[model samples]
Target: MKHTIIFLFVFVFLQKGGLLAQSDGDNFLNNSVKTEHFELLQEFLSIPNDANYPEQITENINWLSDKFNELEFNTAILETEALPLFFAEKLINENLPTVLFYMHFDGQPVDLSKWDQESPYNPVVKMKKGEGWEKVENPDFKNLKEDWRIFARSASDDKGPIAMFLSALQVLQSQGMSPKFNIKVILDSMEEKGSPVLAPAVADHKSVLASDYLVVFDGPMHDSGLPTLLYGVRGITRLRLEVFGPSKPQHSGHFGNYAPNPVFRTAELLASMKDENGKVIIPGFYDGIEIDENAKKIMEAVPDDERGIRKRAGFAKPEQVGGNYQESIQYPSLSVLGIQSGWVGKETRTIVPDKVIVEMDIRTVPETNSNRLIELVRNHIEGQGFTVLD
Candidate 1:
């Protein structure tokens, strides 16, 4: 009996020690919710940092800089030839690999009518049911489930992830689980504006951003509730292609047959770009787009229930072709995002606009390049007997 008890004690001791060792790796946060920390988040959410409001945006950047400084990080404000960029570093060793973490601080403009509370910035806490949210008076975090979410401008879209990452890091520091790689946190102010200046900024700061890997915490997960690890994103190229006929607007009534209606010509040009099944009708559009084994495997993992997807997107039918969510996103597409010419409003109706401006964008897949796609588009337009002007 004595020997059996001793053996049981030894087994228990080793089992418990093994559990602790495994848990030491996940030391970022204790699974406890501290409401006080949320107070600081709410306070930060109240500050306006609309990119259009440059002065207020600067103030917000300074506040974020102060936050890094408070966290004992070596913080610096870097410029990207456009808006200011904040780069904060916390290095444990000089020789360690670096992980560049990216996120944006700016948010979309506020629409007061859509807000639930009085103001989007004056966050209010209210309760009526089981789940809770912060009624962000600022209205940054839209699509909120409750008053616990602030709707100011960029709440969940980005600022929420930014806060979560930083807070997690802070907790990790508190727990003494040092980062394996050198850390670089970059906060951009113009991501919502199509990140026009970001690519150039990254190229210029290649040395400063030299890192083993980059972790971009943007966009959301799949509606199927699966934890996603995106390898790459589809690149976009936007251009305004115009077909000029005459010098100025002509009265369609005066020269119905003789004058070239640019609107009709524009319609014909766009119609030839895509088929009825929504596939890009351009020749060679699908060239070099062979689905690799890995991509096929990843896509096969996606759920294929029409009911579930419809319930999530709040629609009965899929948005694009190829029958599933994965195909719609994976394949390349050419879409005329916007088209404007002449007057369709209340005041104007008689004139045939001479110049038709069609703004189109093409989303490219991995095997394709944006420049080559642009070349294809320009070629297609010119081939259809239309004058091409960049």
Candidate 2:
């Protein structure tokens, strides 16, 4: 009797429109989902091509074009010096405002050995909460696992999002929800490399790329999956320093005191750049960097935990930023990535080297130009009596 009741309840639940129901508020973005569409995503992720694999990259682009054609959308491959970009569009309500969805087809280089599945390019299926499966990896829920998570090079960092978008469109079509707005999808191949070629591509294709607004679907979601919307992103600048003194290496025992080791001099020069408390000694660095009131308000809105963040990050206490994690995320920071000079291995290490190279990167916020920052750093080094060598 209990089994009969359970079966009846399940039947009634499935009868109430089942999994294919679309209400008035149902829109293409959230209302529809298709299993075949998602399987296509798995297939798409199976293509393995990094910046090095030109032939495979072309094949993947062509495959994407065929998929767009199957969806009855116009597709084109925009070519650049590097890999080709795939652009697909379906023009609905010809005069309505168009929103271009930005995505990248290329993925980060991956370590094959560390991959859980056979190949990162072999796309797999992992479901979250039932229905049809999604691509996100889950250690807890392992119900309907398939060899579908594309174990390829560019799987999650980007290709996952692209697949999700297409899968959503496929679902909408299945639910008889043809798009209402002018929809476009841009899949770039060079985004992983700081988008060195995007500016030119955007310029050359400005007419076609013109839109009411641009939506970038990248970066990780906040720890809380509350649908974060960002207005801007920070800029970055890198400085490379090379110090040269003596022409060649000399035995430390013979010329240790006489020869000026470039490594030591480089250390002294770097010391002159910053203080123990993390205040940059460079002049005019903070000249135009007055944080705006809006930025301050945004920073304040972020939650703060005086001690909790430190504990979570395995730190003892607060840092030089004089605040919590939220505030630190809002402020600018300087860090030394690496410094290299002479011997590194188990080789006998009693020689003074002639040259030393220090590489550092700075993350900059708004109103800062890369060229100006470079000039300021160069001037600061020149003021320290060291000849600024290229």
| Residue lDDT tens for model 1, 277-353 | 67887888878776677877777677756677677568765545454667677777887867878888686878778
Q: Assess candidate 2 and give its lDDT.
A: 0.66
TM-score of 1: 0.77
Against the true structure, candidate 2 reaches a TM-score of: 0.72
Q: Write the per-residue lDDT of candidate 2 for residues 1-390, one digit (tens) a residue.
A: 111222232232223354333434444333233345446656787777576677777877888888778777899887776677888888867777687989888776667878666677776544344543456554222222332333455555687667666655554565565544677888888676666677788888888788877888777544333345677666667678888867988889988989998988888888887777666667765455665677777776765554655664677845554234554544445557789888877975888898988888766777566677778888988888888867
True lDDT of residue 147, candidate 2 = 27
* Alpha carbon deviation, residue 51, candidate 1 (Å): 3.1
lDDT of 2 at 229: 68
Best model number under TM-score: 1
- Top of the candidates by lDDT: 1
Superposed Cα deviation of residue 155, candidate 2 (Å): 4.1
lDDT of candidate model 1 versus the reference:
0.69
